[model samples]
Target: MFQVYLIDDEIWALISLEKLIPWKEYGFCICGKSNSAKKAWDDICKNPPDVVITDIRMPGMTGLELLKRLHDSKMKTQVVLVSGFAEFQYAQEAIKHGAFEYLLKQVKREQLKECMIRLFTFLSEQKKKMLETEAYSEKQFWTQMQDQQIKRAAECLFQIEKQEWIGKVCFVASCKKENIVDKKNGKMIQVESFRLFLLGERDENAYGLCIADQEKSSKSEEIKKFLAQVSEQETVWGISRIGDGTQKVSEMIWEAQTALRAAYFSQNQILSYHIKGNGWKKWDELSRAMYYKQNTQVRMQLEALKNEVEVGAVLSDELFSILERIDYEYKKSHGKNLKPQEWIRECDMIHSYPSDKEFFRWLMVFFPVQSEVGSDSAQYIIHLIENQLANAPTLATIGKELGMSQGALTQILKRQTGKNYSELLLEQRMKRAKELLVYTNKTITEIAEETGYTDLFYFSKTFKKNNGISPNEYRKEKRIENEQSTNEK
Candidate 1:
């Protein structure tokens, strides 16, 4: 209910107004009343009300002053000005200051009642729209957050080229709201919500599945009851049989989505997906052997794993375990030099997981060694430098990109990356140059052009200083070594 305050200099008029309106019927309540504008202003400052009905010509901090105060403070309140023809000028100024409705002292009860009703309806509709918009925005935010979290968990569980046990799997659930408008708006149908679960297991490794809890069910029955409730509301769900876990999880999610979509074509309310077998070998077994091989055999097995993930896998304990093991292996291989969390982070990067780099940089500052060598400010400085290096023409160019004075970026880069901007740019240019030398057949001039150096002679000089060898000589040596290895094999 919207609260209302009344202000007037006449005691009889104030009491009359207090008793005139059927406030409760209109979803409003009288919160306070004052004899003068000064008292009303005090009451408002202490306890602001939703609506303020006041006289226009009260002495000492007039109704105009009170209205101005509310406006300056950004208070959300409807103002009603009461005045006679003598104070009509005051009423006009009050309207300019956003008075909701004005009434003369001789105004009738019906006029006051009508004004209050209009105000009530306006506020109610405004509130409903605000609530609906917030609910929609918050839902989208939460869904994106959940999708990102699940994807990260999946990456940690599935290594890029090694299949240790967590095979791919899929889970599907659907939801629908009753009597919602269907396509074309010609008829009413149920709105549906679909959920997919994808996972698997390898050897002794297991990954935990932490789906959002259902509001009206116990933790263990959450997924089951959530699906059941949505189905009862006209939403159908279908889960596919668990498959191999040697492919991208996006494929598995799509497979489960497809299975759920096919429910519309089936007679049964509850359906499960199956691969086309026709007395042939199961795809799961075949994909397991195909994707679970060593890196040397990755190219041969990639297709099978890709197909399994495309069709969705199972949520097995082993799947979670495999991710845990990969995380453990990375930590162990680092010889305790990196934090346990870094293992998960590296896995995320390898799988192209989406992350907030700014947030990640901020988080690293708390690490003991990083705190000593890399302050929070220093990390931002390095990030800015790295970003500018892509097309930096000079130290001034880097500074301009970072919105700093001419030499400002240079000092920060020297402190953070331990080199001036020019040196760092040359270093990165040479690093790319080396990659081209070893991995591609690009010539010295082409590599130089690609590395932002238009002049090949200058590029060669920078490369030699960084690596202590000319670019051509380095490529020649690498070519000979590869040829020798191939011949021996």
Candidate 2:
């Protein structure tokens, strides 16, 4: 229940307000009470309550004074001002000081009740968003740490050091919803309000992790049942078996991922990590056939790979290597690559997971512009950076979002686009600044904020460095053409 604090100069009024409505019924607990606003301010500052109802006419410290103090101190405790006077100036002052609600001395039960309901809703949404963001950050940290050796993963997990989790282990699962395009569309599936941490996107799959509540007795079946409810048709979940604690999290993740891929053979359901596949032992045989252009043998070896991957006999890496080799060889002989999407379907085969970069490449493999072009990963990175420009997103933060480190992000961007991250970020911001200048009527300062520049002077200087003109000059020159175009239109 949300905590509530009540303050009034008159004892009668304080008791009346306290009993005006059933606070618990409305999701609040009247935790503290005071007859002096000054006294209440100290308690609130020491340990802020979620909601504070205070009399505005208190002698030592008026309700407005308390509200101002809370605001200046950066406390989120919401204050509701109550007074006998019905002055517009008091209401304005209350609003200016960030009072959650203002009520008269003769406040009706229903009016206060309605205000409590709004506070309840507002606070609930705030908590939910905070939890979700924590989930993202925790998963981001997990990914960053797990990429290191096992000891590092263990060290990171123990740093959590949650006493309740110390003796318990969770059956980690990797889940994917096939048709998801973006987080907005993809977040619709909630497995009975279970905690979820989205990892990242690859091809048609939006992948995430669900660490089931460790206290549940039948957590394995519990997770599987909930996941099955949301599976519908396009979702698949893979669960790692309950195992030893913290030290095994990395292994649990690997097992869940391998199990998720193995689930490709089975249709829409949850599968547990019970089987292990052979490593890339047959790649030599398949690669030899592809290099010799043994069309019949290549087809046969590919079929062999399909069987092997289906039954967990071989890793999926070899399977893709064979197909990519086939496509490359076919392009060599016929001057055209095998149509990937069509050939995959015609061959009636299953697929294993590829890295995000490879997946994007495969998406555009058949297009003519595929040659001498950068991967969509770079564009995705730039898009994320632009969206976070106001916060001045840096490489470390953006890299965490993509489950990559700053070094990995730098290497990939440089290798793919022949440009470093700062170059891309500056290019994106300047381009956005140019668009807003020519189109929007926002002030230069506003444009600077929009482009991730907090200092107006710095923004103008950088604009000149990149575009050979200050922001105002660029705006003047571009807006003429823009105005003429608008006039014609």
Overall local distance difference test of candidate 1: 0.54
What does the lDDT read for residue 304 in candidate 2?
A: 61
Question: What Cα-based lDDT does every candidate model obtain?
Answer: 0.54, 0.66
User: What's the lDDT of the predicted structure labeled candidate 2?
Assistant: 0.66
TM-score of each: 0.36, 0.35
Q: Write the per-residue lDDT of candidate 2 for residues 384-489, one digit (tens) a residue.
A: 6654566556888666545567897788889878899889888889888999998889999879976888689999999999889899999899878878988999
RMSD vs true structure, all candidates:
26.1, 24.2
Error of 1 at 233 (Å): 24
Model 1 spans > 4 angstroms off: 86-88, 157-489
Deviation of model 1 at 359, angstroms: 47
Compose the digit string of candidate 1's lDDT tens values, residues 1-489: 688999889898888898897776577878789888887777887888889988877778677788888888888888888876556677678778887887887657999999988988777776657666865664554356447855654454344324333432324233222311232422112212222232322122111231232223223245445455433445555443344444434333433434543443322343345554432224334334333423223223333333332333311111223335433433444333212222232223323222223322332321213123224434554444443333445656434433466665556667666886556666666666788899998778767766777678888888888788999999999889999999999
